[model samples]
Target: MGIMGCCSDFLQRVKPYVAMISLQFGYAGMNIISKVSLNHGMSHYVLVVYRHAFATLSIAPFALILERKVRPKITFSIFVQIFVLGLLGPVIDQNFYYAGLKFTSPTFSCAMSNILPAMTFVMAVLCRMEKVDLKKIRCQAKVVGTVVTVAGAMLMTLYKGPIMEMVWTKHVHPHRSSAPETTDSSDKDWLKGSMFLIVATLAWAALFVLQAVTLKQYSAQLSLTTLICFMGTLQAIAVTLVMEHKPSAWSIGWDMNLLAAAYAGIVTSSIAYYVQGLVIQSRGPVFASAFSPLMMIIVAIMGSFILAENIYLGGVLGAVLIVVGLYSVLWGKYKEHKENKKSKVMSLPLTLKNSEGNGEGMDIKDEDEKGKKANSMNLSTSDDRSTIKVRFPIPEIPMKVEAPNA
Candidate 1:
């Protein structure tokens, strides 16, 4: 039982780490698969609509079943929050991210997304959800880590060095037939895609922050996820109707498009949202976003395998920096959490002592009052003896007679 308890405790501690890491793999797969679907000429707007629709369908049943009892009643404010969440995530983030993926390689898109942690940290700080005390070493670590992570992401974006070949990718070569077309249109398209990715990332960061706030009210993770997906489905449909007029774009017939929508909906939207909400609830948005760099790494490797994408030395270097910064932030968070627990534990004795001291002081005050009353009574009795002596003056008598002698 003791060993089992220890293992359980350990698992609870590591669960967030494991969950976020696993989420990165899911996100990596989504990026690659979604990129493929986009390359196959699926409309990004329509894809967003289908993705959230599928997400709503896949997760609604579980949410209804699992959260039927615990789900909080949605008030008007909560409904508004859910609406904004849908706008940020499914409509803005998904559409922009898909459009970005269309113009850029999955690896570059993932690399660009490494900026999420920094953005989230800043927003969290601004929203007062995260604390920042420059005097504290842990706070300093987090600040520095966020800066370094952003710097690394920028370095990856601004600089591309010689291509780096992996052991498994030595013989893998990009097809030459598409090279001329890519070279012709790569510069402007890549710039546009980077802009889209940045916007998407900003929206994604806002979504995290808002989701954290929403959870405070709603509390039910599955229910909130389903609501977000459902709302997003509605919002995305409106956007898709305006942006994609061709009905043919919406037609799905068992291809990568269908696979992309279904997989992203079930895995990334439904499961990912629920898990991320759990993590964000347990830790803050910063910790939840901290694992994004891992997704970049995973996508880098996977993109190389699936897309035969070239890996650059600058990207490699930037990834190392990002990982270092990620660990720094995590260490700071751990230390801060540990210090908080310690402070709470240490404060317990002081609080008890304070209460005890107050009780003792009251007792002492009562005893002091009783002592003063006793002293006053003694003085009064002395005064009464003096008054009797003064009023009926009894003199000292000389006793002369000895009866035994007589």
Candidate 2:
């Protein structure tokens, strides 16, 4: 709470762009750390349950202390919305993402996540929550960015080419006739993992669209995050109980298991969720969305350095495309921000000039005092110039679309 308070105060004094970069790195750290935990053999189901548990516990205190009075009363409709959010986000998203990692590799899963922003954009557009101006550069950039990101996701998932063996020459000796290649591509789990991760990315993207709409009706981001975590805790616990009740899956007496669970619960769930909420509050959801691809880069680098994971050509090309697409969207956003600033600067003079002429006293001769009395009598004169208006930056809450019940 103290850290968050400091962050909020710092953000108030600083620019939003600096806050955005900090958020991107924080999210990237979660991915890299989660990958480390997954490699330690934690069950995805357990991880999901523990994550929600930790998150609920961490946030519930704040909800009680800070938002007790103003918090919206839980109603049947809100319950339904909470249920949907729990199912889609922490339950489905976390489960599938971790399961995908189990079948494939963390690098693969992280790479696939880069497509989320593009998917969200499409979902938002389809729901009429976002408008597109094909002629405008900003809209054009967004459209192109979305297409590029999708293409990158495809490249990452579908194309697994021959390893560029040279990349690992310094790290390991090349296998010759004396030694067979260690990797076994015939494993069915790899393909299954690849497919599952793609599905996970799509599910997460859908969840983002729903959450965006929900945020509109519910202005309290922190409160909404807490509710979702609490609901997800219940949902995950139920599913885990049903699925892992068998005697074989019930064993939990191992250091690795406990460590993995703790990592997922404390670091990934509690800390990451708080950071994400701050990001969404400080920057708009779209800006946060565009940072996903950059997180993949961090994942790839960390995986290579820490776990000695092999990098593939397809992964490289896919990462490049994702970066290109992400930057395109970011560039467009930067341009829009600059344009708004320029527009406001231009409008400032007009507003001041209008104020000076209409509100402030205009220079008049004493001889015209007689005429001034007559002119003042007609207060609502024929002079229409008094009502000059100037445009400013667009306010937040662009449109009315509830975050998805999912």
TM-scores for every candidate against the unseen true structure = 0.78, 0.74
lDDT digits (tens) for residues 12-57 of candidate 1? 9999999999999999999999999998999999889888889999
Pick the TM-score winner. Answer: 1
- Steric overlap count per candidate: 0, 7
Full-model lDDT for every candidate: 0.81, 0.69
Off by over 4 Å in 1: 1-21, 174-184, 276-291, 349-406
Per-candidate RMSD, Å: 11.2, 14.5
Q: Where is model 2 more than 4 Å wrong at Cα?
A: 1-40, 165-188, 248-250, 283-291, 333-406
Cα lDDT tens digits for candidate 2, 1-406: 9999999898775655665566556656665666666676656787777767777777678767887777766667667777898888888888888887876666777777777767777887898976788999998998898889788877877776755444544455444224445456634676677677777777787777877777666656568878888888888888888877664453556565555566566655666666666766676555666666656766666666666566678878887898788777667766666777899988763323323533443221222223333223222222333432232323356678799888
In candidate 1 the C-alpha lDDT for residue 90 amounts to 95
Model 2, position 153: C-alpha lDDT score? 75
